[model samples]
Structures are given as C-alpha cells and as structure tokens.
Target: MNYFQIWGIGFILTLSLSLSAQQVPDTGYVAHWNHPPYAMGEGPVVGVDGAHNNFHKLNAGFRAFGNVAEAGGFRVVSVDESFTEESLSDLDILVIANPLHASNLGNWQLPCPSAFTAFEIKAVDRWVKNGGRLILIADHMPFGGAAYDLGMNFGIEWENGFASIESGGFGDLFTDHFAPFTNADSINSIRTFTGSAMSSNRADVYPIIILSEGTLNLPTIAWNFDSLNTAKPLAGYYQGCWTRAEKGIVVCLGEAAGLTSQLVGPEEYPVGISTPRVGGNLGFIQDMLISLAPENDDFMEALGWLRYREKTTKVGDIPFRFQVIDWQRQPDGHIMLSGEIIGSAVSFEENEEDYFVVEVGPMESDDPNYDDRFSRWRQVSEFTFSREPIVYPD
Candidate 1:
C-alpha cells in the first residue's frame, strides 16, 4: 500500500486521535510589560491577518499574541481582506499565523496549495522592500505548505513535516544563537511542542531557535505516524529566525503555539507561553517587537558616537567616529544632524536610501584648505555606539 493509503487506514481506526488534542486560546493568560515603550494606542500599527482561512485569529486562537503586543504598546488591528497594496499601505507591521488553504481545512493530507496568490505574494514582497515589517508564523504540515510561496519570497524554505525529538516525545528545545538582535544578556532555553522546521542560507538571516541534534522530521499524514514512514534529521535547521528585507524586517517562525498561550486536550492542558517551560518566550517576544518598531526620536537623541572603519587601510585603520550632538526637525519633517568633530563643525544629509551621508577633512578647523580637502562621503546605517572612546594600540 502507498504511504497515504497505509496512514489512511490507521487514521480511520483512531479517528478521535487528532480531535482529542484540540487547542484553544487561553483566555486567562495575561502579559505584563514592566515598562511599556509607548502610551496606549500610540505605538506602531500592527495588523493581525484573519484572512486566508487562518487557524489562529486575533480574537480567537491568537488572543494572547494580540494581548502581549498591546501590552507592549502596539496598536493592534484585524485584517480581513487579502493582501494588496492598498490593504498594506497604512500598516507598519503585519502578523500572519497558521493560515490554511480551503482544501486542507479539515483534511491534513497531501495536495496542499499556496495560501496566497502570485499577485498577493508580489505585493507583499514590494511592500516589505519599501519598509513594512512582517511576522509570519507557520505551524506543522498543511500550515507550512500553505505559506510556502510567501516564505520563499523572503528566503525561507519551509519543511512541511512534523518535527519531533528522535529520542521520543514532543518539546524540542533550543538556545539563543544570536544575542545582539535581542540585546539579552542571557536567555533561557525555550521549549517547543510538535512543530515544523525551516532553513535559510542568506547572510542577513539570524537564527533565534535552531533545532538541535536527534530531532527528526517525519513526513506523514498529520496525526498519523507509523514505522513504515521514513524519517529525516533536522539538525541545524531553524524553528525561528529573522532577516532584513531591503528597508524592512521579517520574522519567520516554524511554530505558532510557542508565541501564544493555548490549552489542549479535553482537560485543558496548558501549552505555549502559558507553560512554565517557555516562560522566557514573553520577554523574547517583547524584545523582538521593540526592535522591529520604527526608531524613536528621543532614543536616537541619546546615542553617542557612531564608529566606522575605513574600507581602505590608508591611515593605519584608525576608525572614524561621528556623533549627532544636535538635530532639528524641519517644517517638511526632515531631520538635520549637526555635530562637531575634533573642533570642526560637521553636518549630515539624508541620502535617497535613508542613510546618513557626510564628508569631513582634517581635524583642525583653523586650516584654510580644510573645505577643499574634504574626504569622500560615506553612507552609515543606524547603530547605537558606546560613550567611551575606542582605543587602538600603536
């Protein structure tokens, strides 16, 4: 018998297997943000997608997600229409969770098609490139298959299989690989229940939850597994990752339960953020949302000197440092950066790519030819710098 036919018989014999583990949003779950970044309803606009026949919606399965985001000061809204330029124009961030195709709604077998159309995928791609953040959460099996096309646009290869610990049991664990993105001194290892796996080789991609060794990817009919099915190791694959898309950022998660609180089974066993094993998930979620938000002007004003190493080794690689000591917002809403370097006045102009570009010469402002000897202008991305000076050995 073929794989599906074999599993189909097993599935029919235990029809209640999948139905018994039904998960619903944990209504009593509460998210606490000690210091909210913005006042209520004053932060970036976040759209939680309810279209595309999603299994998780803002008011239902993903209620804790919206609660956490709102507690962190983001303005959350529901998106009921398909993605289009007009639909995405006003939103600063979009969140999609566990979307399923119409055909795969009740049947989690094969033949899963893309949840999004080619035109919608292109529109979202263009929107992100022009500065729109996206948070995509695709769970196991049909969920991953549904988001395959949209995930591909952002360099993610979704594995549409159930990932579990090869040694047996659910709850795969992971440690943080990239800490700078979250600025956390040390993050506790987080746990994930039966989810999917994904991989990306892009240089810009940063891993948050990397699957460990002994984890196996089982490609089976959902909730039906047997010894006859072949297993593939998913070591080194990512369960959660983030990357920059031109001017915007994209966070792709292989699972959705870990980010939200839910209760499974007839007895209402807690899973996801509600469980004690994943307590660190709330902090991680808050950090990620704060990082993804647009830069705050008050926070930027407190920044110190930004250091940049010269591409050429002409001056023994002594790094150049610039600080925006003062700034003013013009009537047209453009910010002008002005500062002094070694007693010489300097100003920065915004480039077409939104980077700050500036030119400078010798440190001495008394030199008459200083203006004539200006060095080449360079583009610098937004980065926080230390207040202490950088010392290089002679």
Candidate 2:
C-alpha cells in the first residue's frame, strides 16, 4: 500500500480569548460508554490486546478525557450497546474511542479492523443529522482501520497507517514523535505516539488539528516498524477535522494520546495529554468541547422558566418568541445571547437599528401546533438587550 496526501490550507481561527471561569452544570447527559469491539473500556483494563493491553484510566485510553468532561459539567457514562436513535436521543455528545473488533496481533499490522456494524454506523449518521454530536478518536494503523468505515459516512477518509515526521528521526521510539496544531497558540503541540491521519472534502467539514507540512503518513503492510522498505510517505494530511451536520456536530481526531493522560509501563514515562511537558492538547480539547456545545447550561436553566413575550422578547418590534441557542457571560462581565427568533420572518434596517440586523424566515412543519410554535426559527447572532432574560442567574 502507498501513502497519499490531503492538500490545501484551512482557515485558522486567529482569535484567542481568556478562558472563562463561569461554571456549567453537570447535566448527566454525556454518553461516554462504548459498545465493545471498540477500544473504549467501561471502567479499566489490566491486559493487552495486541499493542494496547493496558486498562488503567491514565493510559492511552479515554479515561482522562472522561474525567475532564465530568469535571466540566458533563455526565460521562459508558455505553455498551449499539447506537440507536432512541438510545442516543437524550445525549449531548457520544464518543467512540479506538475500537478493535478483531484480534490484535502484537506485531505491527497494516490495516486494523472494523468494530462497528453497518446498522450502527447508519444509526450514528442519522443521529448526528438529527441534532446529535459525535466525537471520534482513532489512533494508529489498527485503530484507524477499525474506524475507517464509520468515518466514511461523514465524508472522512483515514490513511490506515502510522503518521510521523522525518524530523522526529525514525529510530527513536517515543522521543521522536510529535505533532503540532496549525495557527493555534493555546494548544500548540501534540506528543504523537503512533497515530494515523484523516482528511475530508465535504463542504460541511473544517480542519481543526492539522499536521505540519513535513508530516508523513507511512503505509504499514504489517506492523513492521523495523523495516521501512515498503513505506511510502504521504505529506500534509489532516490529523483532525470538525464537520457541521444538518443539526449536529462531528469532531474527528487522528490521534488519541493528544487528549489522554497515561503512564507507560513500570518506568512510568508520561506520554499523553496530561503530561506536564505536553503542549496545549488538554486545553485545546476542552476549548473545542466548549465551543461545540456551550448551550447545555442555558437549555437546563431555561427548562421551566417562563417569561412574558413582551418583556422577554422582540428584535426591533418583530414580536418573536425567544429561544436561547447560545448564552455566554464574557470574562468582562458582559452577558450575550446569540440565539433564534421564533414565529416571524424578521429583518431590520441598519441605519435605524442600534444592533446588527439579519433576515430570517419561519420554520416549516406539517403539524399545526408545531408549525405555529416553532416554524419561524431564525438565527439571531450577537443580539443583546437592556433587560436580562428569565434564565439569567443573579
């Protein structure tokens, strides 16, 4: 097998804001559990399956991310069954770690195997299309191979091999492995320890973590790191990409240890996201999660609160019902609402209005009740008001 490249540069986000100390609520809605054959363990592992046998929370597994998500007001729960509409409906995010459905040979394998069924893949795809978020973490050869099929549904293509750089020197085991995030200062470096690469040409996709130009995705006919004879390096493939679905979001990363915290063997060499010397992997992942779904807290707060349409609503006298999509309190003590407008096709003239004006139409549905209630849902970006909404905490 020969390696290939993913061309083009991505539009990197240049802005960096001070991280907010504002706390979000733990909604107990995160489904971190995996339906086995996948690499995600329920609790902990104590044995090896091929090259990955360790089961401790601090190893290459996703336990560290689970812990972080838990601390950041998310309820991390393990999943063991196949993904379905009803099963995934209530969750905010579903994480699929490196899964290996077949036996893991300790030797370097060229192509890993699939852990997910066809039905499961379709279910996940539909779930994301219907307002569900998915986070996929696939590692080196075998892990990449296992996830290849599932990722294809989202317009992602995995290289199904090991990706590294010539600068790292192919001889060293751990010391020579590292990957860097492009145009991001907060989470600048990745301590890559044998991971794969991925790319997407879909219009809905955007690169988040990009390997540098010199990065190479080397084909592995077998897990033969000792022999580089058949290896052909492909340059500049995307290591991570985020896609915006019809109503949901999908985050895919080529490497796993970038967001992991683990000790390697008895010597206890740190080689994960939690390593003190590691770059912005931890912070970068946290920021990505926050950016993806910060509205969970707002949704929870507004669950039962009701405000009069007159007092709580209207963008320039359009009389639209308020639906909070994004509510954030900036570090400067300013609270902002970038949400949706319901029940109206509203627009505003710039000269006469004090705030930015945007045109949005009504929602469409066959049900009279639903159509009347939510049919006119249009986005309202950066819409600020003098009075606070009912859901705002004092």
Candidate 3:
C-alpha cells in the first residue's frame, strides 16, 4: 500500500499545511462520533479499556476500517453535546444504535422506559425526509435484540426480542449470564429490502448486514414473557415511518443483532469487501457514515460495497479523472454541486492532443449529462488524479 493508503495515517493529516492540525480526513466528511464505550480515543496518548473490547482510535488497525483516532477522527460524544437542530445540518448521515432492551431480564436493570418526546421524533423524521442516510445497529439485552425503539422511528419493527440461540434455552436475562450478540450483519442478504422509504433517502441505500428471517417479537420491554404470548413480527410494522415528508425515507433491519460484530475466523464468516479478518458489521457502520457525508458525486465505498458491485472503472478513463466545480458548503455543512465527465483528447491523425477534446455539457444542478457521442464538455480544473492508491493521511 502507498504511504497515504495506509489505514490510520490519512485521518490524522490535513490537506494544506496552512490549516490547523485539528483537521483530519481532509478529503471526506470529518467524522462526528457519538459512539459510547467502543470508539473513544483521541490525540497521541489515548488509553484502551479491555472491558469494552472496542477498537481504540489508534489501534483498531486500518486493515478493516481506517483508524478513526488520527483525525480526532471517529469518537464518542454525548448526543446532547454533539447534536442540535443547527448541528443536524452538519451531519451527512446518522446511525442510531439499535441495541436490544431485555427479554431475558425479569425487569429492566435500570430506568423505567426509553420514551421520546414529540419534538425529538419530529426532528428525526424530518432529517431522513430531507435526504439523510441512516444505519441502525442492534444489541440484545433490555430490548431482547428487537431494537424496537429505532425500528419504531423508521416505521419498522423487529419482533425477535430474545432468542435462545441454542435450540431451546431460557438464558436468564436480569442476570449477568446473558451474552451479547457479536456477529456482523451480512451485506449480501441485507440489500434485498425493497422499501420505498428506504430507497428514497438515497438511491444507494443498501444493507451491509442481513439478519435471520422470521425473528420473534416482544411488544413490551425486557424480562421473560409468556413463551406462548410472544408475538410474531409483522412485515408491515413500518407502515407510517414516512410519506409526504420532505425527504421521506426509512430502512430497517428485521433483527438488530445482525449488525453485531463477531471476531471469529474467516472459516466461520465473511465481510462485505472481501476483507477476511474484518466483519460485515464494521463495513455496515462505515457505509452509513459515507452515505451521510458525501463530499462529491465521487463518494467512496467500502470493500464489498454491494451497489457498485457490477460497475467498473479503468485508470485512464476521463470520467474517473473528472473534476468537480461549483461545490459549495452550505450554511448547514451539507454540499450542493454538479459534475461532468471529460473524454480523451487523443488526435490520431495530428497526434497533437495536449488537452483532450470532447464536447461535454447540458449540465445543471443534479442534471444528468449525456453527449451525442464520446463528447467532453467544459469542467473546472480543481481536481487531481490519483497516480496511485491513497493510504492513511490524517
């Protein structure tokens, strides 16, 4: 790998030396993380807590996802401190953890309930309607892997509240004996969801994780319920997540635990991008972030990005070498702009093609460009081609 392509390096460096050291990942969205416990390391001297078993900012190793620590990169922050109506504008995407509440525990360990205010629900609904991409990861416990809260917001519901993975076992909840699900979601299986609300948010909203079919549902909170009384999950549970809303959109996992990460060997499972060691769960989270914070039409995708699985680009293609102009940072930090594909300037007869000449055009905001033949329209000269792959550059 070239020096820049190294996983953790790029995130800690800045594009122009004149800029402050605080800015990293100069190319894409500077990540804003509110991940509690797992992703929380910054600066040079950060510590690791084995209890949580999360990727330390610096040590998670780019082999899977790039190290988030270098850029002040991915981090853990309090939701209230990191988000506001105004701050919402800064985010390109949002991923709310869908950890299960508690099917096993007799009563929830703490707190009476996890309720949302009317305003909070409205803000989230509004965000997706206006083109925000979202990903939800599941956890089992108080919620029993149903991840019902997030599913509720997205007009979906996961019924498998507490599964006894081993054929038939009650694995007591309320007690510490219950273990968390760590298997990564399967991207291949996830993309099959055909919900319009899911697709409208982004033409490319596909799944990175796939959960088991026919999940069980516990309508209420954690604790053992009458086995005979538990409800079967219904597909239409997501009926009103959105419609007539501005950016009206929603996508949901039938089971939250599908996004859980498992550290098993390649013999047992596979990741989306063909990264044997990394889990699809990691790719699922990274994919959500990339979707939310797209910097240009040429946004990056993870190892096994499913949407572009069939598309191919050669090194010398002009469209791949195309430049982006008119890209402006909106007051809310969202970007708006246009793009064009530049064709080759080769002149076989004259052999004088300093600049490739193709008639490019009919371009406007979000407008598709199609030339009569192999045409090259005018484009801004603010872009540079990659001579080689980019490594880490924080």
- Best lDDT goes to which candidate? 1
On TM-score, the leading prediction is 1
Ranking under TM-score, best-scoring first? 1, 2, 3
Q: Each model's TM-score, in the order given?
A: 0.69, 0.57, 0.39
lDDT tens readout by residue for model 2, 1-394: 1111211111121111111112222222232321121233321211111222322222235566766665555556666556667666666677776666545545345445666779878888998888677877777666777788888888998877665545323321111111111212234444445466787777546665455434343545434455443344434466677775666677788766556555454555444554455555555555555544524322211211212222356666676544443344545333344333444556444322222222222334677545222123333344443222333332
Off by over 4 Å in 2: 1-60, 105-108, 167-191, 215-223, 226-234, 294-394
Write the number of the candidate with greater TM-score, choosing between 1 and 2: 1
Off by over 4 Å in 1: 1-20, 167-176, 227-230, 296-394
Q: Comparing 1 and 2 by lDDT, which wins?
A: 1
Question: Which residue pairs of candidate 1 clash?
Answer: none
Prediction-by-prediction clash tally: 0, 17, 59
Model 1, 325-365: lDDT tens per residue?
43443444333443333211222232112123332222236
Tell me each candidate's RMSD, in Å, in order: 13.0, 13.3, 15.2
Judge candidate 2 against the unseen true structure and give its global Cα lDDT, from 0 to 1.
0.49
**Candidate 2 local Cα displacement, residue 35, angstroms:** 32
lDDT (Cα atoms) of all candidates against the true structure: 0.63, 0.49, 0.29
